[model samples]
Target: MTFPVVGMVGGGQLARMTHEAGIPLGIRFKLLSDTPQDSAAQVVNEVVVGDYRDLDTLRAFARGCDVITFDHEHVPTEHLRALEADGIPVRPGPDALVHAQDKGVMRARLDAIGVPCPRHRIVADPADVAAFAAEGDGFPVVLKTVRGGYDGKGVWVVDSVEEAEAPFRAGVPVLAEEKVDFVRELAANVVRSPHGQAVAYPVVESQQVDGVCDTVIAPAPDLDESLALHAEEMALRIAKELDVVGHLAVELFQTRDGRVLVNELAMRPHNSGHWTMDGAVTSQFANHVRAVLDLPLGDPRPRAPWTVMVNVLGGDYPDMYSAYLHCMARDPQLKIHMYGKDVKPGRKVGHVNTYGDHLDDVLERARHAAGYLRGTITE
Candidate 1:
């Protein structure tokens, strides 16, 4: 009996972890990577070094795979459509993925569906950005390039039109939105199979540091139960409406006024769901694979009362072996997952997950381990 082949485009840590998840099930992975050194390419045995942007390269890569998936949203939508036209199943097909690829499209579609979102509009110029601001709360408006931005690279919170000019300079369509007055950020993660079976993980509170995710707390301490249910239902509805057949992460803003507004949508495994690696009955990567394969969904229940995941950002220290020893010896319960990437300042090299009954202790343990690994905490 031969296992099915899953073609994963892009070679980031997401693909790396997803490949690991498939190991137990004997699922074969074919990876298309930019370089042999890419995170996933280092581990996936069948690596094809090619440019995902090149149609010929993509066509060659998909020839033998049973189905195609992605480590990121950057793949050209037309290319995905082309693959589907060739009878290759692309999980989270182009129609649904285009929304995540383009901010303007996502905002427009979400609005049409009556989803709660911050006031926004596509702005053509700095003057238009100012006008958009005036239409809302004014100044300190948020500007984002409609495509190709990630990890806070294509976003700006500008106090004036002068500050908004940079986004338009990229020559991409720019989306202007009101700066949400949110108390904190939240994430609702759900997995959907092609046949419509779906499961929602507990809502999680995600903390960002300079636009990059730093930490995630499962069950979002003190979150209203009704609102959590609403967020979960909303995510499930979105998956069905958009025809998404894999993991969908709804990045949200829980406003100070007790409202939750949609901030962003990720159509694959996301940083916010990282805690599921150790804290949940099934990891997001494993379930994502199951979903794309149209297999039974897994239980999304948490194993512990509180689970905290802290990202280990690269710092001054390039060699983390010593730090790893210190952290592991100190907290044997800690789970450390590292990507095989060379450390560079501010880059996400790995993460640490800590779970327990007490939220504070869980948070501290995760933070301390991550900090120690990054050389931010000596003791």
Candidate 2:
């Protein structure tokens, strides 16, 4: 049978990498982007420039495609539901999409399902922050906007009641949560199919700098077997609970007391899993495509004993291509991925990944190469 064409919403880097995965699977990928200069548009030829929030744009994009999925969760829920209502196939449908769309909705649903999470209170107004602080854990609680928060944006730390009032004064809807005292941050990833088959990847440790991820160590260095198993179990449980028919990324916090608390969720391919592209037996982008296409899930095993990925921030390099050669010359084993984006301060330009039989060797090489790219080292 001939493979079906995949229609993807959003033409960002995730879609660009997904296109790379689709090529090997013999699947056609069509992208819907608002601009011609989007990352995926530069790589994938089949694209329609349109706003994902517009039903007319969506209808046109969905036409002649066998299945619909997303690069990001920014699509209007009503538009997605309308597509389904019109008999279009949208994977990880509106029911599952909502969890990624609105953090408030996700917190409530996960809490109802008895998922482990930090104590939180919804603040329709900034005053509720002080009220929650008084009742719940006080000082240094996190203030986050329930919607449109990502990569440290829309999140703030309130040391006192006065600090919580800043967002309200700015007209932002915020939610207060007890600031988690965690030992480390971990990410569990899994992909589920429409057939109910699912596979989980090894949980990895993520290192964040000022709310942006800078590095990732796969299999999470010094991870206890029990904790690793627990993380995978938590990921599997969430995928099943949400009935998600695509890749799901569960961000977790390992508390000081050895308990893992749910931090956040991503229903699409996540930055934390980018190491899998050059490290795992099957990349998340490829698995997501297979899941949404209703194909059998691929192996989630690691190809090597260890894999480490370091993100390259845009501002660190004067010329990305020049830095690329310098890094590659030093460590040829390092695999570098450069997104076709203009260099800008604090933007994620690309990543470098290293894999090997020895975990230390992989990490050492990855770090050195990454540091070189960032101009932290001469060699």
Q: For residues 50-162, could you state the per-residue lDDT of candidate 1 as single tens digits?
A: 99999999999999999999999989989999999999999989999998999899999999888999999999999999899888878999999889888999999999988
All candidates' TM-scores?
A: 0.99, 0.97
TM-score of 2: 0.97
Candidate 2: pairs in clash: none
lDDT of each: 0.94, 0.88
Alpha-carbon RMSD to native, per candidate: 0.8, 1.4
Screening candidate 1 with a backbone cut-off below 3 angstroms (N, C-alpha, C), the clashing residue pairs are none
Segments in model 2 whose C-alpha atoms lie over 4 Å from true places: 169-172
lDDT of 2 at 268: 92
For every model shown, the clashing-pair count is 0, 0
- lDDT tens digits by residue: candidate 2, 133-212: 77866778798887788899888998876777776666756777889999989999999998899999999999999899
In terms of lDDT, the poorest run of 10 residues in model 2 is: 165-174
Give the top-scoring candidate (lDDT): 1
